[model samples]
Target: MIAIDNKLISDSVLEAQFVCDLNKCKGGCCEDGDAGAPLEIEELNELISNYEVIKPYLTPEGIKAIEKQGKYIYDTEFGWVTPTVNSGICAYGIRDEKGIIKCGIEQAYYDGKLKWKKPISCHLFPIRIQKSQQDEDLEYVNYEPRQDLCKAACKLGKQLKVPVYIFLKEAIIRKYGEEFYEALAASAEVVKK
Candidate 1:
């Protein structure tokens, strides 16, 4: 494990490889999960505040689910999370003509309607940031690639020689700080060698 500040990063973060190939995966991570996308408390508040702008991007079914279930709901296993449509896909998600589910929040962000870019958990995908059970203040930054859905991503990463940590550089920086990502990069140099 590589310790950086309050986070204990998994070795796989430096060793494993991944790069999302949305064409093959078709955004399965957004829809296939049992629960909705996990959200931070601040993110829940942000989503609520931005819902008016983001609502236009979501499907009618998604909006209905949000209206019925609230912007976000408390999950027993996952804590705070976005409400899902029919207990399946996230309510804030929109399906494109390609049949791929995309984040309405992200679409709003891209269209300059909102500042927030979806949930932190969604952005830091495959690299799950779970709070340490022993110390809630501490966090585990682990690389947890879905074996079934991430085959193309893993194959692509290996072909490109990109490590998981490097592949998720922007996300890691967004969740952690520039300094923390720099530390991970420094460690990757030693670990990969």
Candidate 2:
């Protein structure tokens, strides 16, 4: 496991609060495509500029897939035109013969091409930025699960309680910028509706 250190922009949170339900998630985000609230062009550009190595891995095919779908990010309501090649599995993910799904980007990151990493939301599971507010602030929200997802069997849309703010903050700032990262942190704070 990789250890990343950073202070959360809000709250007096600490490392003790975060929990990654890796076993339970089963790569749900990649398999279940959704048009996340799109990022601004500047933010997207920052990711590309600061992390150019992964740019190649981000195949034009993926962009075309998004374009064909009429959006940059996949969404549930619109559905994918090209069904996930691996039986609805995300393009960069694959389940090994042992039936364990491994994340390609994460693998690449460990392989030394750190540029092949994902945005914070992609890297930080179970937590997503659902909406952006007008004050340049954003609202983060959890996705509605088909069933209970946590080991605690917590209901969907309930706060993830994973204490991932610091991890996410580092990821967002590294890929995007402190500004975009700050907005995302604020967004992540929205109470679940």
Candidate 3:
């Protein structure tokens, strides 16, 4: 678990309720840009072993970039850091005959072939989980609550009836579990007043 700012975590856990409305949205979050999630050790191994499976979708340059960077960073605008290659599309991202996008990962989860899967950085969206200023702590930056996002996702947001607290709690619980849910709920409730 990453160590995060208590205050930011509290606020984000509150706001997340407003952001997740699956019914009205077609998982646009999943379809969006590679949110720069770091590959886990297991995931990296999977790629190396089954490189053939995903290689077809990646440009040779992209593959070379990942291979050369090796996930560690030497220098960039952000200074030394672990590079997160935009893995591009989800393997299960498919368009039905009707052109509906579907998640292969969620489908696999439902089918019991995969358990407890979500890209780490993707799961921590709007709530940044990164090293602190001194790299001694993990900071959970709260979502800025973009007005544009509200306009874009409003239809589903309304349908999901995403009360801020509920949405945030659900997000946390989805990633962390019941214990996190209870803690976030407690934090959010106290922060509200």
Off by over 4 Å in 1: none
Predicted candidate 1 versus true structure: per-residue lDDT over 56-145, tens digit per residue: 998999999999999999999999999999988889888789988789999999999888888989998988989988998899988887
Candidate 1 residue-pair clash tally: 0
Q: Per-residue CA lDDT of candidate 2, range 156-191, in tens?
A: 112555455453456556655787666554554552
Q: Mind sharing the TM-score for model 2?
A: 0.47
Best candidate, TM-score-wise?
A: 1
Q: Each model's TM-score? A: 0.97, 0.47, 0.57
| Candidates in descending TM-score order | 1, 3, 2
Model 1 whole-model lDDT (C-alpha atoms) = 0.89
Candidate 3 total steric clashes:
6
Candidate 1: give the clashing pairs.
Answer: none
lDDT of 3 by residue, 1-193 (tens): 2122342453543644455444444445544443334443455454445444444434354456557765334343333332333544343354445544444434444556455344444455545444457555455445543354345344454567564546555446665678766766666556667
> lDDT for every model?
0.89, 0.44, 0.47
Candidate that scores best on lDDT: 1
Least lDDT summed over 10 consecutive residues: which range in candidate 3? 1-10
